[model samples]
Target: MKPLTVIGFLGSTLDASKFGPSRWSKWRPSVALTMHEDLRVDRFVMLHGTPHARLAEYIAEDIASISPETTVDRRVLDLVDPWDFEEVYGKLLDFARAYPFDPDAEDYLIHITTGTHVAQICLFLLTEAHYLPGRLLQTQPAKRGEDGGAPGRWTSIDLDLSRYDSIATRFAAASAESTSFLKSGIDTKNAPFNRLIDEIEQVAVRSRAPVLLIGPTGAGKSQLARRIYELKKLKHQVQGPFVEVNCATLKGDGAMSALFGHKKGAFTGAAADRPGLLRTADTGMLFLDEIGELGLDEQAMILRAIEDKRFLPVGADKEVSSDFQLIAGTNRDLGRAVAEGRFRDDLYARLNLWTFALPGLAERREDIEPNLDYELDRFAEREGTRVTFNKEARERYLAFATSLDAIWAGNFRDLAASVTRMATFSPKGRIDSDCVASEIARLTRLWASDTKGDDDGLDPLLGDVALAALDPFDRVQLAHVVATCRRSRSLSEAGRALFAASRARRTSSNDADRLRKYLTRFGLEWGQVSG
Candidate 1:
């Protein structure tokens, strides 16, 4: 079995012991820890200040005398003042970065018992942060009541918080709060989508690997990527600005020069040395939106850049390096693009490591109401105007927005535009039935124009065969009937809407009976039409 390596500060005062048969005078915590039979120490890395260098040597000699088989490596880490946490932590962190760690060859432990309080804290931080891939070992003086008392005891503690219920609960709650913050406080109803966001929130804070967002346009891929960057920045996980590029807008050599820069006089437009978006994203995040639109040559270069962190700029002789986290957003099916020889299959495989799919607004209609409020809030902040829908108007608009008629082809973007139009047109800070009606009409016209084939809306209700059998005049009339029936809650409501002019002419109104009879002519009932 591979032996365990122990690392810590040399306890100058406590480690220099007087020779004695009594355990209290003879045993030092660091020496006792090394002497533990089952907990074998193969390598000991002792950190010491200049003042304690001689004492550290004495401690090392004693440790060797007690545990003859272990190898000792001492490091001189001079802190101006060991009590100053900032200075102490910085020096220890630097040492940890420089130290060679081989986790596969040996298990490791941070010996926290021998250091000053500040040094102990710094060591714990390095270990917990994964700069030191090791558990912690603290040695304690032996129990005094035992006959002639024995040597000190050693204990190993793990930093995995899941092993402790109370800590795990706290961490889980904090993680949930962070996830909600990343989502802009919007509570999504779709369980899978919510879970996906939660996972993404964790990954954004924990890992710096490339993330690929796959979804249709306006599905919030770009927004989520920016949010991830913001979250990482908020946590101090990244120190640079978020740089975004839409690959779809980039074309040819201009795209290359824009992303990777060029040497002075390298091209006609290159008047001076230019640093590009990749370098701008150093120590931060790079969001490549519509990444599938990138040409094959750029894809190959990007693959090299992501894998090697080094790439030669356009017409540049030497390669520049930028260590940036990548977040790629795409509406296209890259797998299909790969099969068709459009995208590089190798690059696709690399970016596919961490992939997420964002659902479009049409798929999460239940979230529309909350997102409506969110968009209105954004508009108010941006335009310096506040607009709200009346209770009835809000209900009406939400019903229509959630309906099948509202195709929402542009997803969140479409919803945001709809809200913007209504909010802009609303007078006196309130949107009523009139405003809702106008916006609905405008949206309907927009959606209608965007759609292809039949403008005859009866195809959904009556199907093709039934519609073909009907006269052109009858088809038009039936479309109106079906639409009215859909909007009404009952037969009488449909009758009132469809026969408003005729009902006014009648002395005695049997509107419900008339509507029922009319619907029977088409072999349709209230349930069939309304549902």
Candidate 2:
């Protein structure tokens, strides 16, 4: 076994005594610590200031006399004010850094019974941080009934709490709770989405930097942003109010006035001095939804505000400061926008530091079931009427919703609306098969109408005669394929998106060739469909 080493401060009052055997009658922590038969410390590192040098030497000699085999190493730690936390911690930290610690050969113990409270705390922190690689040794004086002169009891506390199952379990539970809170307690099951949320939870709690959420509309970007703010508030990271703004609604001069605040007489509508959304969110959070919709000028201003925390209002020479954490949400591709000269590259770079892309409902089909139940619970709370689907109806709705044919154009919004409609039209409180069937048909019609709006491109590509001969299923499928092709950069990308689920099962697959053959069957080519 490795030799035991004890490192502690010299207790000026507790360890002081005249040069005689009578000193043994009085219990000195340092002297009694060496007398313990079980704890055979091979080395005792005694620390003290310049004023306590003589006392440190006297205690070292006494400890040596008691246990001649033990080596007592005296260290001088000069401190101006022992009560000052910063000074004490800094001095100890420096000492710990300079000390040679050999954990492999020596079992180290930090004695906490011989220092100021500040020094004890600093020692605990250093040990916890592993600067002092050892366990804490807390010594208590003997009880009143016990022998007052005898060496007191000592307990060793390991800083690595994972060794203790109860402590480890509690920490894990707390972490899971934090992640669940960030997800708004939805219990999402999608593996990628769950991992993303876990990473987001860590970043949200630790960072005040700008975060950019990228996803399609109704993918819950705004809701997620609000949840992040709420989580931060729960952690006491922010004290100000959560200020949310939809940049899509702001236009030209109004956008500037609303965001950066305008001085009196700045514009025709600006009659009074207005503190903008940024100022209102001071020392808090600012969520800018549909951020990509903002104009180039506004984007530049926002970048300045984020970086410098100060910006000038309209018609004002002076600058106003607002230190707010920014959370930007956008469906549009800012990188593409930057390439097209629409968005400022600098602003995009700034916001892209901590960017997270949320998957749409279609991508996370497994999560839809939980979110469905959540939506129903929300409806019950809002309407003060509980509603549920029968077994068959619930299974039928889930089957259709999870199927590839169901196009969730509005993502979660569409799911919520469908649940609301079915709940409202259900006979009594329970949704029967008839209600679910009618809701499904209604959703199909709505999705079909949306597809038809984009079907104009189909007529021109397929021509009148070819389109007239095709069946309704063929027409709809071909129209969707052609539309996807037009939107994608290449045939391969379109095929990958079109066959995302099936492609995973194939060991050796050529999506481009498969797409080429499918297009050939319909007398269409990549150039014609993509063009």
Candidate 3:
């Protein structure tokens, strides 16, 4: 076996126990290094501040006497304040970088019992970063009656906590709590959605890759992106502002200038130089909502920006660079757009690396109550007054919200608006049964008008013969699917959106095939529905 090497700080006052009258006393950590049989310290690199140098020498002499085979190398490291994190961390990092590490010949360990908390933390950071490659050797005071009540006991702690079952369990719990935090306290009942959020949390923390959120409008893509940005900000991963833009709102030269900046005399309204959204997103995140609506020219520029981190501004000779994480949100079927020669295929391939499809409010009906409470809480905060639903009113509202007939086409946005209106119109800061009834009536009317006078566009699409042949339930489901497909850029996109729940449970995800089969049952084809 390779000899064990230890790198550590000499305990200034603590190491003096070696010279005490009692030779068998186990108070000092340095003297305890030779207590183990199988574990032997071949070489010790002792680091000490100016005042601790003498103590270090004395400890080194004692170590040499106790273990004649062990080599001792002592060095004086002056730290103004061992408690100051930055100063100690920088000095230790510099030392580690300069140290000759021979991994093939010796197994290294960091003795953490001799330093201040700050120094210990720095050592941990360096080891975890592999700047100093080694496990940690922490010396702890032995429990009473344990090993004859000895003072110092050496324990090795690996950086990967999976070696300890208890630590791993605690870490997993902490991770789950963090994932829940990212979801804004909405403990969703949908298992798949929860798992997706968990995966997203891991990805957001670990990578700087571009994330694509594909879901229908008001499905919380934009909100989730902002939450991710907040999480990263809390971790200090990103420092710049979160820049957001709706691509559908941009047009022509304005779109180019807004996204990629402009030269002083670039266009008609170019009064001064402008540093675009991409530049504004430096060291941060850029959220492009309705990304599918961007023109081909803009799409190509965005692709280049995402891939190379550089893009040419409108009418500029030089290309500007912005290092930013991209989070693109779209309700359109990008695959169909690619097939139809709208969205670039190369860009689709790049963005598809980490694509997550969000389910709408209708699909996650079980989570309606929690989301309702959340919306109410948000409403109270925004309006600067607390407004709550009475027990009966809340239950009634939840039931109505999650019902099959209530088509939440606008999803969370609509839900927020409903809560806002009800709270604003409520009496004495409480929503009673009458208030819920009125809100329900208002929503029903709004939805009825939205679907074009309650027929829901079914009559026109089905025709009399086809409409009469199918059962009412099948007709409703089929009509909804047809509407989704018509709005979708491709059949697969529509299928994924429509059968999101079914696809979650399916081991083999052939969404397009399943959708095609369902459409055929209704005497429908991709061409007919798309047209």
Candidate 4:
């Protein structure tokens, strides 16, 4: 085994005594630490100020007399205020850095029984951070009725808490709780999404840097941002309120004024001094939802504010300051926007440090079941009435929801709305198969309408005359096929979905090939249709 080395401060009051044999009567932590028979401390590094030099020498000599094998190295660490955490910690850190720590050949222990409370705390922190690279040794005076003349009791605490199963379990449980909190208590099963939440939870707790959330509308970016803020607040990381801003709603001068505050009479509608969203979020969190919608000018100002925590209010000469943690949410492709000159590249780079892409509801089909229950619970809380689906209805809804045909265009918003409608229409608060069927039909029609209304299914690619030339039957069938292809990730996936019922009936089913030929019939390629 390696030689044991103990490092500690000499307690000026406790370690000090008369130079004769009377000093050995009382229990002094520093002196008692060396006299323990089981410890076998090979070296003792005693730290003290100039005033305690004589006392330190006396203790070291006395310790040497008790333990002839134990070598004492007295170090003078002069401190103006021993209780000042910064000065004491800095001095100890410097000593730790300068010291030759040979853990391979020397076992180290930091004696915490000596020094001020601040010094002890600094020692613990240093040891925990592995700067000291040792276990903590805490010595206590022996209680009454015990051998008062003998050395006091001592305990060694290993800084590696993972070695203790109970402590490790508690830490793991706390981490899991944090991740669950980030997910808003939803037992999300999607591996990628769960991993993303875990990463976000870590970043939310450990960092104050800007976090950029990229996802489609209603993919829970806003909700996740709020949850992050709440978690931070719970951890006492922030004291101020969460201030959320929909950047899409702010336009031109209004965007500038709203984000950076405004002086009274700064603009046409500015009748009073506005504190702005940034100011409102001071010492807390600022969630800029739809941040990509902000214009170049506003983006530039935001970048400055994020970097400096200072920005000029509208019509104000001097800049105001607001220190806030930023969580930006956007559906737009910021990388493309930067390349197209719509977004500032510098700002993109800054926010890109911790970018998380949240998968849409359709992408996280496995998580739909859990979120379904979550939405129902949320509905109950909102409506003050509990509603549940019949077992068959629940299974049927889950099947349909997880199927590719169910295009969750609006993501969770659509899911929540569908549930709310079903619950509101369900007789006696129990949704039956009929209710599920109606909701499925309603959602299908709604998604179909959105897809068709936005882009007249093959109208953009094929002009009016080409679409008009087709038969009504062919037009309807082709339109639906094209829509499915556009929504699908690949030709094979689209083919599997389009021919879900019939693919198994065929002996050698080539779904992608079948889809390719079908598209070719209308002189349409997969690339053209899918794009």
Candidate 5:
């Protein structure tokens, strides 16, 4: 048996207040502590107030999601109550007795960092008793003054020299690589909606609750919902097709029957048995749009469906079962409605599991140019137009986009309409500020005429400039340009970086396709950008 590595987690009233759950954004304090596979490890966490056993399961789930390859025995040990050190000693005795360490396996890497007083005492006990095979402290606040002033200085301490160093180094490298990989992926896509994507992920993973995405019409609420569904699917947390219903259009008896299904002859109008939206959405996501408009009675029925995971079909004698994750979207403030007795509080409570407030187009001023540019590309591709942005026009578009205040209050629909107008009115295949600004004025009039309000429109477009140095790909592509112009390495030097390493001996046409993809990411093309 290898040394039974014991990891100590701090679970105390004080520590609980400082870390865990709410500190979700904090990158793990010491990736160094958790990185090695060579050492056998176990984890113990302490929490103040909350049930430790219950919290342990949440932590275990999170850790498994993030690092699927690792295995560890996890527990929450409480010893701070009654202010007795013996409570701490008693718990450790049981743990140490069960899985005695075997140093021969190069085993027993104890990594514990939790927020609890009992955990701290346990750390001290293991060190004093010489039973701590390996240990890791996840976080340490700077020592504060008597009056809570600065304790001063930051430091790192490690034990177990070679073993600890080896483990930490390997872990750091892998962590850095993963960080770099995600960064590269995000950068490559220029994902302007990254914030929305991130919010959905955190909300889904952290809480087993319904997420209500509220935004103005055409603000891409449905699109965002589908994107979230896809991401959840990728994570294997969701398996059912995304079932969507626009509640504003669902009317009277039809709405109930559509959502709850009906048995033949149960209702006067019913001719045959029908399965409702509730069942159709079994084991998947049910996206309800315009939920604020659902009638009071229908709201009660839907609420029951969500809370009980079962619902009665229209005209059906018995209830049917279906499990579905609910994601509701609305433009109205349901909270205010609840207070005014306009919305059902009971149903609201169930849907309030998690709520995400989406920023309107006007609020996300920074996103205007990118979204426009993306739309422009889509239009250009659809038209098969050889469109490249001109400097003055692009800059002017960007300026207008960033300058808007109440951008139509219509959200994404307004933006799409603006894009269509700009594309339709462009004189030169490329668009300029005139295109963006003119549409804004036009949209202002159209929206204002419709609502008697000067609701706003999209900002100007941002122009793209070819890098003076060309991208890495371009530089390499025109290597001959480099060879002839810069008088640098000949075609040979360029070929090596541009070619596959496997074909060191044969250079011509060697893995050029693979090289181009990597080069494109570098922002380079053959002769134009390079040399």
Candidate 6:
């Protein structure tokens, strides 16, 4: 709700000729100016009407992500029109006086966008007379061409802001930090999350820190870690597969065996010698999911493995060392758990050295739309449905989502489930309020009935929603196998149930390939989400 950050992208849209008719249309000139990447305007105050709303909407929608802080405002100060001279002059003076810039000079960024020559002249005059705080308007080209029978044909020029006025004094920091990992690094150095990403991005490139991504499950902590991995991949020392380890499955002695390779007869279950996860992840990133669940004994062993880069197998006498980057994940708070004698204090400290905490969906409500848009695109591509939610639907959905309590224990997972359900059931092309409401109501009734039903009848299963699409040409079917996996939430168990039912449907190597592809897109392994 802060004031818009003004950035001047000022230029001219009129390219009328001296003698005959206008050499080219001003309509197209204005049109092109609207699409300029750096032109940060929120409310496009139209100078003229013919090149109307559709132009404003496109520019606002397109650059909305880039200029997160600017408000693109437009106003047509008609000088030659029938209105009296003083009336026009008074309005201009008032507008220049009331322009929503911070009282202190340093807070605003003036980006003057291209329009009429008169408009640029007016802005220059106003700024020069101290009516506006910043510099003069910058006039940019309306058209690009090789020659109009001259050495070079140029339509516009970069007029300095000093043409109108100039000022000096700068002590304060920015409204937000300019440092970012993405194209607009504004958010990367703002507040809480800023320090985390900045340090991570910097140290990740320079030093080697066994990154431990700790956050509530489904907070996109892993995704952030992956981003860091990608960023590091840009550096010289990093390369190879980002191997993953689920310590939840590596229980007791089994955990030891999985982490450190075992010789044949290392244990009763060790029918064959095998390399541990650490080795399999050699010279790469080894992601350990649910690190909090690791037992005390296992924690001590992992500390050893980390310190020495070596570990003794469950039954093997010799030691094997691994050279791999370790990245740990967990939903539980190891700090609190450590104080209470659950997670090991030492392990927690080592992992905490460089950490990133992803704010949950309900925590950072501003990000809901962006995340939803991303998820919608992802699900649409996967489902093969050209589904799009209209503004009304998105607004309502976001409002409802942002209003939720912190108990959205599942976070993005829950939102995704809701979206996938809506897309699957909502009539062919669009999603609306009816769709959102109906899904919620149907689930409510189902839950009510399930809880209240008598033992006399079979307990009804929950509303298990799954989205699947098919590519008939390849004879490949993308099925979430919703029916068989009705009772499961885990991806692996669901996949197991799916495979059990899949055999009854059809047996094909192609189906397995399709399934693998689906798993990759979902970021799930056969063991994670199946049954």
TM-score of each: 0.54, 0.57, 0.56, 0.60, 0.47, 0.48
Q: How many backbone collisions does model 3 have?
A: 0
Error of 6 at 106 (Å): 43
lDDT of each: 0.79, 0.84, 0.80, 0.85, 0.56, 0.54
User: By TM-score, highest first, what's the ranking?
Assistant: 4, 2, 3, 1, 6, 5
Give residue 165's error in model 4 in angstroms.
48
- Output the better candidate (2/4) by TM-score: 4
Best by lDDT: 4
Once superposed on the true structure, which residue ranges of model 4 sit more than 4 Å away at CA?
1-179, 456-493, 501-505, 516-531
What are the per-residue Cα lDDT tens digits for candidate 3 across 9-67?
A: 88775676645557556667766775566568898888888887777877777778778
Candidate 1, 391-419: lDDT as tens digits: 78899999999765676778899989998
Q: Tens digits of per-residue lDDT for model 2 on 257-299? A: 8999989988886889999999999999999999999999999
For model 2, give the 10-residue run with minimal summed lDDT.
163-172
Query: Best to worst by lDDT, what's the order?
Result: 4, 2, 3, 1, 5, 6
lDDT of 5 at 431: 59
Model 6, range 1-531, lDDT digits (tens) per residue? 323234332222232223223432333333333344544334433343333444445444433544444455655444454234344435555565446544232333233444444444544444443344443323344336522211111122323322211322111222235555521223322255555666667767776767777677777766666666666676646676777766778776777777777899976878998987877876777788889888888888788777778887777778888776777888887888998998998888888887766666545555566556556655644543324565577666766665422224466776677778887665343577788677656545543464353231111211123222323332122232432232343445444545655666765535445555665663445444332
Off by over 4 Å in 2: 1-179, 455-477, 482-516, 519-531
Candidate maximizing TM-score: 4
lDDT of 1 at 345: 99
Per-residue alpha-carbon lDDT of model 5 for 325-344, expressed as tens digits? 88899989999999998899
Question: What are the C-alpha RMSDs, in order, of all predicted structures?
Answer: 21.0, 17.2, 17.8, 17.5, 25.6, 20.4
- Lowest-scoring 10 consecutive residues by lDDT in candidate 3? 163-172
User: Which 10 residues in a row give candidate 1 its minimum summed lDDT?
Assistant: 163-172
Instruction: Kindly list the per-residue Cα lDDT of model 4 for residues 1-531, writing each as its tens digit.
Output: 889999999999888777676777888888898788789999999999999888888888888889999999999999999998778877887787679886656789999988999999878766764557678999998888876455989999975431111211100011235338888677788888888888999999999999999999999999999999999999999999999989989987788888888999887888999988899999999999999999998889899999999999998988999999999999999999999999999999999999999988988889999889888767654553446776788999999999888889999999999998997786345688999999999999998788774654677777888888999799878888887886677999999989988988878899999999998888889999883
